[model samples]
Target: MLRKALLTGCTGFVGHPLLARLSNCDFSVVACSRVAMPALPASATNVLVSGIDGLTDWQVALAGVEVVIHSAARVHVMNDQSSDPLAEFRKVNVEGTLNLARQAAEAGVRRFIFISSIKVNGEGTPLGSPYRADAQPQPADPYGVSKMEAEQGLRALAAETGMEVVIIRPTLVYGPGVKANFLSMMRWLHKGVPLPFGAIHNQRSLVALDNLVDLIVTCIDHPAAANQTFLVSDGEDLSTTELLRRMATALGKPARLLPVPSWLLEAGASILGKKALSQRLCGSLQVDISKTRELLGWTPPLSVDAALRKTAAHFLEHRTH
Candidate 1:
């Protein structure tokens, strides 16, 4: 019998690709979203929920689902305009997620897979000591805090209900349709703009979209993945300078980077109130995925360079469209 899986956030960057992958596999997917999606796979069923919140009903969607991939949540924004950002995040990311998990457990779902963020661990890490799976959570922002709380709730729910829970915290994910800082870097590199990140030597771990999706799929049926928290990355750490060079190579452009002192750049950013942005560019945040490798025996199929090339190719293909 084909395993039935209920997938939320089917229209999101990760969820969309995941739905496709599940549809192609032995799983019968019910793609749940707030709104309808275009060109959904024929093998998958589409179910629309009003919204994800503490009050939302998921019984119809959880009818025969053996697995639940809950990706829908209030994501992080640059400058949130809400009066109470934490409350807003808690409403959807924490309360809404737990509500769904409870319903899934009641409906006899075996596993609940949560798509979490690296920010749950912390904003940045020291140079040599990367965060491990067992690291204490120190979520900085409201969004990160919400994810951490949601994970806690899921674990408790699993223990109480005997429903397995798999939590995956992925680092900065980049690929086609990427936005924010990663998109900005690609734009600067594509325009042949001279970047001032030549001298900074901060290491950061990143995961490609395909690699993350692959990991999620692996955990769907992997026996050892139950009740496990995994940190996923490309397994190769890259400095800001090295990342730009790789992106330039992928874009087939000359790397026009000016060597600038990290402290000087940080000082300028602080003066301009862009300290957070500067830290992301000049600071280090790495995760050790050794547990994920040893326990699940899984490795990222795509290399960093190859993934960057795919991202560049997508950007170049859609730049004029």
Candidate 2:
């Protein structure tokens, strides 16, 4: 039987590829977005819902939708200028999400899959002690707090309405068409710019876009995923130095790394008001996906090296033009 799935944020970084993947998987997808989307697959039916908020109506799009993939949320921003960032995030990530899930439950939607963030687990973990799937949530930012609240609301709703909810918290996701820090790193590597991260030994677990999408697809119908939360990654943690070296390898560039002491870097960043940026580059944040694998029997299809190569290739192709 072909499942009818409703996908929110169809134009987002994760949702765009997810829409295509669902369509390719023969799912009759209702691609919901705030604006009209072009180049959708034949299996996808586009529906416009202007902005996700408490009042946004999902009735039309939720019709006959057995599975709902809610990837739309107020994502984290580096320098948020909003006066009340927490309230801003709560309006969309928490209220908007609950509103959609409630309506989906009312519409008889069987399963709802939410794409959350690893920030819900806290900023960083100890070097050897990675966060587990069942770890207590210690959201460090407004975005993370909102997602945590949304998860709590969804759980409560699930118990009340019997609509299954699957929550997936993924670490920094990167692949083709990646932007922000990952793209910047690639750009710096492409230019053979010498970096001073040779001595920074912090492990971070990242998931490839394809791998994350694959996990979401698996959760759509997997019986074990019902009412469960999973943390996802490539399952291979890499230090700052190792990651740059691997990226350099993929880019076919020499890893010109200077062994600058991490203390000096942190001190410099603190003086320059870049402490957060420096922490991100030199902090250890790892998640243990053993539960995700044990329960769903899923493994990342794309290796980190392969994903980096693809990212590098796309960067080179786009940079040249």
- Please report, in order, the local distance difference test score of every candidate based on alpha carbons: 0.94, 0.93
For all predicted structures, in order, the TM-scores are 0.98, 0.98
**Which stretches in model 2 have alpha-carbon errors above 4 Å?**
none
Per-residue CA lDDT of model 2 for 1-321, tens digit only, reads 668999998899899999999998979999998888888898889999888999999999998999999999888776899899999999999999999999999999999999989989999998989999898999988988999999999999999999999999999999888989888888888888899989998999999999999999999889999999999999899998999999999989999899998889999999999988888888899999999999999999999999888888888888852
Model 1 C-alpha lDDT per residue in residues 1-321, reported as the tens digit of each score: 778999998898899889999998988899998777778887788998988899999999899999999888899776789899999999999999999999999999999999999989999999989999899999999999999999999999999999999999999999988888898888888899999999999999999999999999999999999999999999999999999999999999999999999999999999999999999999999999999999999999999999999999999988853
- Displacement of residue 47 (Cα, Å) in model 2 is 0.7
